[model samples]
Target: EDQVTQSPEALRLQEGESSSLNCSYTVSGLRGLFWYRQDPGKGPEFLFTLYSAGEEKEKERLKATLTKKESFLHITAPKPEDSATYLCAVQRGSNDYKLSFGAGTTVTVRA
Candidate 1:
């Protein structure tokens, strides 16, 4: 089974404060690691895809990087609008579309 674990289940940050979220995984045959941002009561929005170690992707203040056993989502100078639940998922070779997700890190950026 592919499993993912994210740290600091919840975060409270003042506006303009930056932080990083961690996603650690254990899988039999790793296919890809994915990062998503989900607002309250909404489906997750895709953020990045990491197929191999050392792969990185960025969008505005969000940057995602992957390694052999973990991935990191770095948020730089976040605002209240950037607050959301960040989810980390993993897909194994057996299933192309099925993703096992972590519990998610809920970020609260207060203005």
Candidate 2:
């Protein structure tokens, strides 16, 4: 079965702290990896799309990278406004866009 798991469950980062969260997954066949940021009571905002192994994408203080069986989201100098849930999702193509997602890593960036 294809599944995703994120570590730390939660993270506390100082305004200038830089850290990375982990999302490990196992899929029958990997098609794509996606990274999204979701705020409380809001839909997820697309951040990056990784189509193959060794691919990466970035935005502002966020960077996303993908491997064969896992993906990572690195946050550099996170700010209070960056506090949100980081979600990782994967699609196997056999199914629809109902991406299977990790529980998410809740990050709180303190000012």
* RMSD values, in order shown: 1.2, 1.2
Which regions of candidate 1 deviate over 4 angstroms? 95-97
User: How far does residue 49 in candidate 2 sit from its true spot (Å)?
Assistant: 0.9
lDDT of 2 by residue, 1-111 (tens): 779999979999999999999999987677888888999999999988898999988899999988887888999989999999999988876756557999999999998
Q: For residues 1-111, could you state the per-residue lDDT of candidate 1 as single tens digits?
A: 678999989999999999999999998778899999999989999988999999999999999999999999999999999999999999887746568999999999999
Report RMSD for candidate 2: 1.2
Task: Return the top candidate by lDDT.
Answer: 1
Error of 2 at 97 (Å): 5.6
lDDT score at residue 44, model 1, on the 0-100 scale: 96
* Candidate 1: RMSD to truth: 1.2
Question: What's model 1's overall lDDT?
Answer: 0.93
Clashes (candidate 2): 0
Candidate 2 accuracy as TM-score: 0.94
